[model samples]
Target chain A: GAGVSQSPSNKVTEKGKDVELRCDPISGHTALYWYRQRLGQGLEFLIYFQGNSAPDKSGLPSDRFSAERTGESVSTLTIQRTQQEDSAVYLCASSFGQGQEKLFFGSGTQLSVL
Target chain B: AQSVTQPDIHITVSEGASLELRCNYSYGATPYLFWYVQSPGQGLQLLLKYFSGDTLVQGIKGFEAEFKRSQSSFNLRKPSVHWSDAAEYFCAVGEEGGFKTIFGAGTRLFVKA
Candidate 1:
């Protein structure tokens, strides 16, 4: 696709259930990012992937949240044992290069934890 | 540490009127500044960004922003806002060392007819 694409545009999961979100960055772009935006809150950086190296997972809210990227292409964010507070819009973005470059974002997955 | 702040939670502007949105940041040295707009149920779209050289940067959607080093601020402006401009705007800052960028609590704009 010409732009970043994210799967499961909307997802509803029961509390304590696990969920997975996928993202496909713009073709040939090396940088991918994950962020969560709760209602009335700013975008919170959750993780970032550059190439196939180790991802920057410093922003993950807890141990239950984890992510994986394969060969600088597709990425997945997994949330284990979700809670109501986990409900938010999960956004994915990509850039041609890393480090503050122009970003292209996906429409995002609106996750609802019931 | 670097951070961003958008003081206005919401602003209402009439069509064809000028618009200004305030943004402040706390960072050592010159920071990478950016302004992004998000329509309801959509992803963020970059309006403008400031990296170096000229502090004033032009962006899409008839929007522009000036980086004021002295004030530690980068504010977004539009000469004549259209009704379609109504959306949520976010201000963000990035340091030189890392790819992690922090965003401010966004300002929601309403276009009054």
Candidate 2:
């Protein structure tokens, strides 16, 4: 891919339903990140994957929020029992490595929980 | 805890006017600072970044940022504003050896003719 790619550009889910957002990063990138952008809000860090090391889940808002990445490729963000507050844009970014190097971002998945 | 603060929620500037957006960050050690721009319905793109060396760093799209360790501030600036430059700007900071980077709330710039 020329850049990071996200699936389902948009998603509409009823409250209490589960939603999944996917991301396919650029080839050979060694780091991936997940972030949530609320309406008129900043990027909220969700999770980070670096190579084969353990993921940094410090930013997940709650137990309902979880994400997974296989190697340095595709990653998925899953939200269980989604609530109205879950409505936001989920963004995925991959970088050459960790340490806050340049990040290539995807257009993101807009999730609307009604 | 590391954090980045962008005091202005939004600002309006006339096209061709000089611009400045303020940012402040808190980190434990030497910080890596960055400015990212997001256009409508688009993903964020790096404007510039600062880690070491000169306090002033240049970035793409004619954007520049200055890292002031004394005040823990990394401010973005442009000599002239362009209507096409209207967008949301984010300031971020990463720890010296940490894996994660945190972003500021963002400052939306409005370019008026």
Candidate 3:
């Protein structure tokens, strides 16, 4: 792909429903990251994956939030029993090898929990 | 933990006027600094980055930033403002060889015609 791709650019789900956001990173990218942006707030890191290493999930806000990636290709972030507070933009980014490499971001999935 | 602070929540500047946005960071070791811009209903675009060597860095769209190690600041500047430049700017910091990047709250720029 020319750039990072995210699915379901906009999603409106009822509270307690489950939602999944997908990200297809740039071809050959070795690192992937997930972040959340609330209205008028900064981006909060959710998780990071580097190559075949164990993913860093320390930033996940709660037990309801989980994510998975398959061999550095596509990734999915799943939110179970979503709440109103979960209404925000979910962004995905990828880089060549992490570290100081520049990150390319996707358009993001705007989830609105009604 | 690494953190970034953008003091101003919003700034208004006249078109053709010079502009500057302040940013500060707290990190234990050398940090990788970055500036990104986000237009309404759009994803973020990287403006510039500072990893090593020179303290001043240039970015796309006629923007530049200087890394001041003494103050732990990476302030973005432009010689002249444009109406199209009205967007949200974010400053971010990451540790060397680390995957986590912490972004600031963001500064909204409004350009007046």
Candidate 4:
């Protein structure tokens, strides 16, 4: 696609259940990012993937949150044993690698933990 | 740790009035400042960015932002706003070669007729 694409535009899961969200970065873009935005909150950086390098997972709130990216194309964010606090819009973005400056974002997955 | 701050939670202005949204950043490396807007049910769209050289950068939708390194600020401005400009704006700061980029809480702009 010409822009970043995120799957499951909306997801509802019960508390303690696990959920997965996917993101497809813009073709040829080598920098992918994951962020979580809760109600009335700012974008909280989750993880970043640049080329074949290891992702920066420093922003994951807890052990339950994890992510994986295959090369520079697709990425997935997994939340284990979700809680109500985990309910938020998960956004994915991509850049043209290297300097990784301005980003192109996806519509995001609105996750609701019940 | 690097961070970005948007002072105003919300602002309201008439359609023809000028607009200014404040943003502040705390970072050690050379900063890459950006202003992004999110319309209702839409993704974030970059309005402007400041990498280097000229501090004043122009962007789409008649928006512009100035980078004031002395004050650690990058504020978005518009000579006159329109009703379509009503949306949430975010200020962000990133490192030159780093992967992590921090964002501000965002300022909600409301354009009134």
Give me the candidate number with maximum lDDT. Answer: 3
Error of 2 at B94 (Å): 0.5
Q: Pick the candidate with the highest DockQ.
A: 3
Error of 2 at A96 (Å): 1.5
The residue ranges of model 4 lying beyond 4 angstroms of the native Cα positions read none
- What is candidate 2's lDDT per residue for B38-87, written digit by digit as tens? 99989999999898999999999999999999999999999999999999
Kindly indicate the candidate among 2 and 3 with the higher DockQ.
3
Select the stronger candidate by lDDT from 2 and 3.
Answer: 3
Tens-digit lDDT track for model 4 on B1-113?
89999999999999999999999999987798899999999999999888899999999999999999899999899999999999999999988877677899999999989
How well does each candidate superpose onto the true structure, as a TM-score?
Answer: 0.97, 0.97, 0.97, 0.97
Instruction: Evaluate every candidate with DockQ and list the scores.
Output: 0.75, 0.81, 0.87, 0.81
Q: Give lDDT tens digits, candidate 1, residues A1-114.
A: 988999999999999999999999999999889999999989999988888654578899999999988987999999999999999999999887657767789999999999
**What is model 3's native contact fraction?**
0.85
Off by over 4 Å in 2: none
The lDDT for every candidate, in the order shown, is: 0.92, 0.92, 0.94, 0.92
**TM-score of each candidate's B chain against the true B chain:** 0.98, 0.98, 0.99, 0.97
Total backbone clashes of candidate 3, pairs 3 or more residues apart or in separate chains: 0
Q: Write the per-residue lDDT of candidate 3 for residues A1-114, one digit (tens) a residue.
A: 999999999999999999999999999999999999999999999999886454589999999998988897999999999999999999999999747778999999999999
> For model 4, how does the per-residue alpha-carbon lDDT over A1-114 read when each residue is reduced to its tens digit?
988999999999999999999999999999889999998989999988887464577889999998888887899999999999999999999998777477999999999999
lDDT of 1 at B38: 95
Q: After the best TM-score superposition of candidate 4, give how far the Cα of residue A45 lies from its true spot, in angstroms.
A: 0.4
